[model samples]
Target: MITRKRGAYTGRNKSSAYKDLVWTVATTKDTTLPLETQIQETLQIIDDNLKELHSNKHQIVSAQVYLANIKDKPVMDEIWKKWIGDNPDHWPQRACLGVDLEGDVLIEISVTAVADL
Candidate 1:
């Protein structure tokens, strides 16, 4: 069976889980925030979502990050590294890309993790 968390839109749920794996994505609701704040907020949302799905950052297997500006990757990378912590084992395989996002949104992140259950 699949577990799903509803999203703001009808066409899609925020995240879904099946068996051992849970997938989720997040963006800051307030786009006016600075890039660093946006990344921090989005990651916090991801943290919450992961816990709701019975997992944590350490369980994340992979991640995909989208940025409105490729030029900001250095900034994004710095924050991401801090968030992932110093444990090498906890770092997930991650890829980031510069993409045109909707509205003032500057950053978005998607993650997949294995649930403890």
Candidate 2:
């Protein structure tokens, strides 16, 4: 029953935040790359954060993906499916939406996962 917080922010200061068994992460894609590459890059960021929390994709309980354009869903989905692999049982509940992300970021992802004990 440990609580950890990563990327916490207070008046311009930032750090990671976690609580109990769950860890959370939020990231945006590098718009300089193609949509597919952005998806890959975003997923990599998620993977890295999960690793830091002693978890992996399999432990993700839920996720929210934001796209600059809703039409990009299909392509993003394709990359997401590949990144998560073929294990349906390991999949998390997810949602995607169109948003106005900051900078040149075309995609953004936020995830919540259970940490490994």
Candidate 3:
């Protein structure tokens, strides 16, 4: 089994490592945006990171989403459904929770997926 990591950085240092699969955790940078937009952007980031690992939404095994406000769950759900598309079999096990996010970040998403390789 192989593993990969991306966007893993601390302070001013950076690293580039690739393996069989990748697990990524990302948060929205713009909390001022509407919940829907934030969710959409977060999903886009997930998609991009998965692509780097030769994977996609279909390969996702699990996902965790953090929200600044629980009231926005419905809105986030709508966007999440559309983002994952129509493949029910490809949907990952997911959970959402309310949390105190830093800065303007209104939403955060983390996912684990298998690589096509």
Candidate 4:
């Protein structure tokens, strides 16, 4: 069976899970914010989404970061490193890509993790 968690954004599921894997994605609601703030907000949402799925950042196996500007990657990397932190167990195999996002969205992140069964 597949489980989908509802969210306030566009009638879409904030995260969806099948068996033991959960896929989640997030971006800041306030798209007008600067890159740093957007990233911060998006990560915070992902943190909550994971917890709701009985998972956490440490359980993330993969992450894909979408950026409106490729030049912002360095800054995004710094914030990401700080949040994911020093533990190897907390690090995910992540990739960042430059993409044209809707509106003023500076960054968006999608992750896949192992959720509690």
Candidate 5:
């Protein structure tokens, strides 16, 4: 079965114990917020939507990040570490790169997670 929520989409099996979730990012035109702030807010949006599916899940399996400026990478790295934590075992497979993000945005992150069904 498949389900869509505010920030995440999920595929589930009633008899199975796991569900796959895809986080959807929000796009905005306002550029006044700091890059790190935007990243944090995006994560929170994903979190809020995930609550409708399962609330106790914490580990992410993979992530893809896009940044409008390579110059912002250092700053983004610092904030990402704080948000995703520093544990090696818990770290998800990730790919980050500088790109022309939408709406002149500084950054965007997409995550995939497996959670209890």
Candidate 6:
């Protein structure tokens, strides 16, 4: 079975979690900020979306984070540590990669999770 949870954002909720899937994407970017600032902001957005999914029956199974610069990994890791510390149990398969960003954005993530049957 599948279902869509709705809340608030612009047009639709920021996240979508199905009975057997967890769909999460980072919120809009802070274009004027530095790379580190953007990365932290993006992580916070991910956290909020993940928390909403946790309120339902699904659990995060994996996360793929993208960065605009590989050299910024250290800074990104620092923020990631703090975020993960808050909800240790929700840890999922994770990976980070360096790639060309869409625009002024420095970070983005796509997460997958599973809802209990």
TM-scores vs. true structure, each candidate: 0.98, 0.82, 0.83, 0.95, 0.73, 0.72
List the global CA lDDT of all models: 0.95, 0.76, 0.77, 0.94, 0.62, 0.70
lDDT top scorer: 1
RMSD of 4: 1.1
Error of 1 at 17 (Å): 0.2
Per-residue alpha-carbon lDDT of candidate 1 for residues 1-117, written as tens digits (9 for 90 to 100): 999999787998888999999999999989999999999999999999999999999999999999999999999999999999999999999999999999999998999999998
Q: Candidate 6: which stretches are off by over 4 Å?
A: 4-14, 54-59, 86-89, 114-117
State each candidate's clash count. Answer: 0, 11, 2, 0, 0, 0
Best by TM-score: 1
Question: Which pairs clash (backbone N, Cα, C closer than 3 Å) in model 4?
Answer: none
Which regions of candidate 4 fall more than 4 Å away from where they truly are?
none
Candidate 3 residue lDDT tens string, 1-117 = 434453545542111224655577776657688777788878888888788768888888888899989788898898988888898998899999999988778898888787776
What ranges in model 1 sit over 4 Å off? none
For lDDT, candidate 4 versus 6, the one ahead is 4
Per-residue lDDT over 1-117 for candidate 5, one digit per residue giving the tens place of the 0 to 100 score: 656553222562211123455444443235668787777775665565445556321666777778898788788778778876767877788888889876757777666666655
Cα lDDT tens digits, model 6, 16-109, are 7666576777834667798767867877777667666663312667878888887888988887777666676767778989998777777887
lDDT of 2: 0.76
- Location of the lowest summed lDDT over 10 successive residues in candidate 4: 5-14
Error of 3 at 3 (Å): 5.8
TM-score rank, highest first? 1, 4, 3, 2, 5, 6
Winner on TM-score (3 vs 4): 4
Put down candidate 2 lDDT per residue, 2-111, tens digits, no spaces.
45544534543111435534555555444688878888887887888777767888888888999998999999998999898898999999999999987878887888
